[model samples]
Target: MSYLDPAIAVIDPVAAAGPYGREGTAIGFRVICVLTQEYRTPYVTQTFDPADFSEVYQHSCIDETVAFLKSRSVVAVVPGAPPSLKIVDVLAESLGLIGNPTESLEARRNKRVMKEYWTRHEVPCAAFHESGDLESVISWADGRGYPVVLKPNASVGGVHVFVCANRQEVVDAFNVIVSRADPYHQQFSTVLAEEYLDGDEYFMDLAHTGGGEAMPVAFAKYEKIQRNGNASIYKNMFSLPLDDPIALAALPYVRSVNDALGVRYGINDTEFKMTSRGPRVVEVNNRLPGASVPLMIQRCSGLNVFQENIRIFVDGRRTSGDYHFERHYNICCLINDQPGVVQGYAGLDEVRELLSYDGERMIAPQGVHWPVTRDLDGCWGLIRLVHEDREQLSRDAEAVHAMMRLLVA
Candidate 1:
């Protein structure tokens, strides 16, 4: 690979203090990062650096952005997160590059539209309702009975996601969802109410080459705990081998969902629930998995989706069939329930001393004010553990969970 080759344009590559930033630097690629005013929040401003990219372009006007990219030696346009999906689609189509269909953009981004597309395509998914009025959503949930999920139509990382067990809970969740905008600063005009699927939740990372053909890079199960009245707060997630039964059972359904959404190229991070009725899709993201999932997958499977993404989209390489488990890996999300100024980490040293403790990221460092962990943004940090022995990995994970504490003043 030549470092002087045409650059790959990445939109909103801000997650995990710059996963794509490190990937671009390590792989010797000239990357152009497109940013919008929506990503200028305190968290992003504190963690991300525009100097890390080869070139930074502010997306103010679509015509001007398209004109600028066309003037440069740009090879491909890909989304770095959920907020950039539509822009990437538009830019890729304008540049005549490989990307998902522009007409199906809403199907890939909006939760209600995604389910509606899946239903039209006969892809198995949870029953859902979408409406802007609170009473309309409540009535739909009431008809569906208790344990319904209420969330924004277009949101990521479980933002405004709530499980409502009664009318009061639905009203509260609806109010909260409509009261504020999403991380992208987009208003929530419509709320999606979905049937809560009671089963193990799993997410699959895939690379769609072309012609509705894609390859699974990794499959992992999520262990979430209900904290602060939120039912989808991620606690821990571990990688699963390709030969694992759950992986085998969910592969076909995941592929069908990819096709239904018209994902012709680029990476897809899809979440599913293995229900008693069979595998059902929870949501599909037409981008890489959020946080450090790509790094953890590389540790376990020896395949990095970030690197493969560039190869597939820029170099026109076929998807690799060599994806398999090399080791067991788990990432435990550090949860903080206390909201105050940061005092210190109580048992961080002990956690690092564990046999399976590989690495960690302290999102909320010392002296910074922290809030109670409610959504993905409120996470204290991430601790990664890897081992050849699954049992030992589990033990170390549990120990880390017990020992680690984020002290607050």
Candidate 2:
């Protein structure tokens, strides 16, 4: 598309280079990238190219940026990452474009505010408290009993999230979260503590084309193994059929969550725990699912979230029909259990030889010193598996974990 064509403003296009950058071009719209150093990541700094964008503007001042975006023929404003969630709302409201309500920005981005909104709307959510004082957090957790969860009020990729089994653990977890800045480089003044729900965690991807309704697009159950006191170290995530029993049960609750958060436009990625009580929400993100999840969904189900989102915003198309899987898909996270300098990856050839092996993203290259894989961000890389047979896909996914080893010295 020509630069003169109508454009979409994508703020902090971190992991969305493929989606809003390249795929947006394929769908016939110029992409205007509003860059930010505040949300820097390896994906943004090392992988993204400025050439992919039609016009790049540094977001040092919001007024200047909004003024510039207003000068262009921008039709819609969308967030490319979590840090840009609030900013996207601001821009969209300022530009008079289709987007989420700026009035409920906190309900979409802050964990504490989100839960409060859900509770007010009578949506089932975990019990929680937010405070900067350790005594206040510990007191709340004590009343709730042992094994509470502690995390930043507005952080992504499971940064500093810990499942504390006792008061000591809570203290330790609290110190860690408050001691460092979040992935977005913002210091945490308050930590959110919530009662830990005991059950399997599942990821549900939804889209709100327009109106008050949000459609369910895809669902995946996360296989998380607790290690080193962290409760949500992702092992693998496999796609579930639309008609799956769990998917059926969780659909209504997730849709309610979408509505509660005021996510009337763009994609929503919500994580829910299938607790003994029922399906309870873990967290809600008003952006595309991270870790190339949309790509995997497209590969297996032929539903390109990126393309569909552009179609909805740019072409004014409403989504219809249900999503179905054409192939079994699994995303296996490559982990380094111990921290050290990387030597090389072992048994990768064997992993590639598997019938279900589709592709891999090796984030930690050889000779790079890396920390132990405690959360999604610390993972060595990710290996994607796809096959016609679900059994073969499962076997290959397990084999990937066993065969592929991150050799850290």
Candidate 3:
């Protein structure tokens, strides 16, 4: 396969000190690092910055990134995170690289903006309004109905996302959200108050080839755990059959949302809640999936989302087949609800024996300080079980949850 250049530019791949920044470089792709403001604190303490990349350029401004790419004769730009998506889109636009329309970046990042655009385009979306005033937000939600969702206009992994049932809950939620700072160090003063869509929730993953076709790769139905009108835990995610009725109905809406947003090329992670009427989009992420989604997909489907994404950007290639896997898969994640220092864990040996498989983990090793679950990243780790029978998978998930425990001090 031919790549645009021997060296591809990757922007702010998590902490520069980690293996993520060197991922492409290790795989025979020359990856140049473009530093952004959101890198991890450990990276800074280690003095191991992205600038240490073999062929690196550090710039905070998007315009500067374009200039650096031009100066370095860069061919392809790969964004590593949500914040970098817009920057890379801008670079792609300015440098004539294959990517989604740069104008869509605003809608891609901001939920409020995306909902507005979707409403204007008649795309299926729950009722939403953006405002800093708690009373105004409550008024909008009151008009709609109970169980309104309040979330930061731009945040990740359901951080500070609240589902309120009444006026007091909405007031408390808005205050709590606005008090916290986002990844970009900006206060979430303006939140998006949305009518909480009641139904089954599912995520559809797609690859938008610059060639004008959006290819479906994978789909999963999520089961969320709610606490005090807040989604503090994300439980089981079951892979839906390709021919499932819900999957079939949601595909067109996914395509329509991408097209309406002027997404010509990129990976799309679109979440939809199936209402009594039909499927309505809850959120759209114009980037790769989070957590172990990529690994799980590759394990089950034999399709690597990262490699396919690279091909889309560098080779302008897109797959043209229906997505399916040979086996059924179920994934479950855990969140730390108790706040304390981590001493050790229990029930793992029994859990492994019961499940007969060791799933992927993302927990902080023992002795590390563990925080209470407040948002998505508070998740401890995940366990994915493969089963040919869907019913058996559900039974195994319950056994895992009952047996596994995260011990806290």
Candidate 4:
């Protein structure tokens, strides 16, 4: 499924540009880097820098973007983040490129809208209410019961999400959620409060064709670092065996949620809570799975989520062949709770010896004062580990946690 010269327009690949270029190389497509900043990366074949009019969705900027696309016949447009997705949707629709509708992107990016859509379509989800009024949210939570999850209407990486067990906590958490919204997107201020479903959490990464079909690449079970049994400050995700019964059982619900969202042409990261009633949708994001998931999935299984999305859009199909699911149980740990300046890392040589990792990945740059993590985005660093046996995995996780110290000032 290698393309000879299929030019793909990618919008704002994050981390100063690496993923998009790697994706292009993986699929043999020439990536046209369309960015918001004057960032440079070695992976892209060509680059285009337009005016900052799109920060306000300016008409002139859109015209320039269209003009640039016309200069090269792009086979598809791939957006990295939610904001970038909105921009690409507008540009793709204008240029007749493959992408989601603007309205769908808008709705999907907002939690309130996505929940309403799921509710209308009879999708299995938690009871939720939204308002700028904290009193109303408190009332709704009171009726629902002890715990409720408050989150910003529009966000990424679990930003401004709080689990409140009481009315006062709800008020404090709601204010935090509201204040965390992006200033430009006013609708984001409308916070959402949902009846928190306490259960085991899991996530699935997959690619969809927008044709009512989804191909699951990898599945994971999460272990949350909870504070006072309410707020999840950190997340430890372990890649479940692909053929595990729990993983198999969640596929139908995943497909239903994907179809309900009208997902067509992109990678999706869907997180859910497996309650006593059944699996309930926590959130469905139309984007690539973050952190070390893409690499972990490739290590555990032959299927590459990023490349699969490209193949889905360009070739109108997924990677052909059975996945060689390695028996390795991979764990991705996000150290969010530890806060301070990173003086140095202890047991670097020992941890590196015990764990399998790419040499380039580290906790974070040292000496910068680190703040207390309030959400998933504020996580300090990612530590990836893998093992073949469950007992060995548990033993390795403990050893790594104890030895891989983030020495803070």
Q: Give the TM-score of candidate 3.
A: 0.90
User: How much does candidate 1 score in TM-score?
Assistant: 0.95
Q: Over the stretch 82-200, how does candidate 2's per-residue lDDT look in tens digits?
A: 77886888887777778788889999999999999999999989999999999999999999998899999887777789999999999999999999876567679889999889889
Per-residue lDDT value at 337 in model 2:
76
User: How much is the lDDT of residue 360 in candidate 3?
Assistant: 55
Clashes of each: 0, 0, 0, 1
* TM-scores for the candidates: 0.95, 0.96, 0.90, 0.86
| Model 3 misplaced stretches (Cα beyond 4 Å) | 1-5, 15-27, 41-57, 183-186, 354-358
lDDT of 4 at 292: 63
Query: How close to the true structure is residue 227 of candidate 3, measured as C-alpha lDDT?
Result: 82
Worst 10 residues of 3 by lDDT: 40-49
Candidate 1: clashing pairs of residues: none
Best by lDDT: 2
Better by TM-score, candidate 3 or 1? 1
lDDT by residue for model 4 (1-409), tens? 2335667776765541235566665657766667643333211212223321122112237789787777767777776545565577778788886777776776567677778888888888988999889788988999989788887776665666778878888888877766644312333566788888878989987677666457677788887765643355555677786677987898888888766666777777899988999999888877777666777776667666667776665655766643556745545454634678878777667867764543325545588676565545456556677666666666666766676666778
Question: Which candidate has the top score in TM-score?
Answer: 2
Model 1 ranges with Cα > 4 A deviation: 1-4, 40-47
* Candidate 3 displacement at residue 62 in angstroms: 2.3
Which is superior by TM-score, 3 or 4? 3
TM-score of 4: 0.86
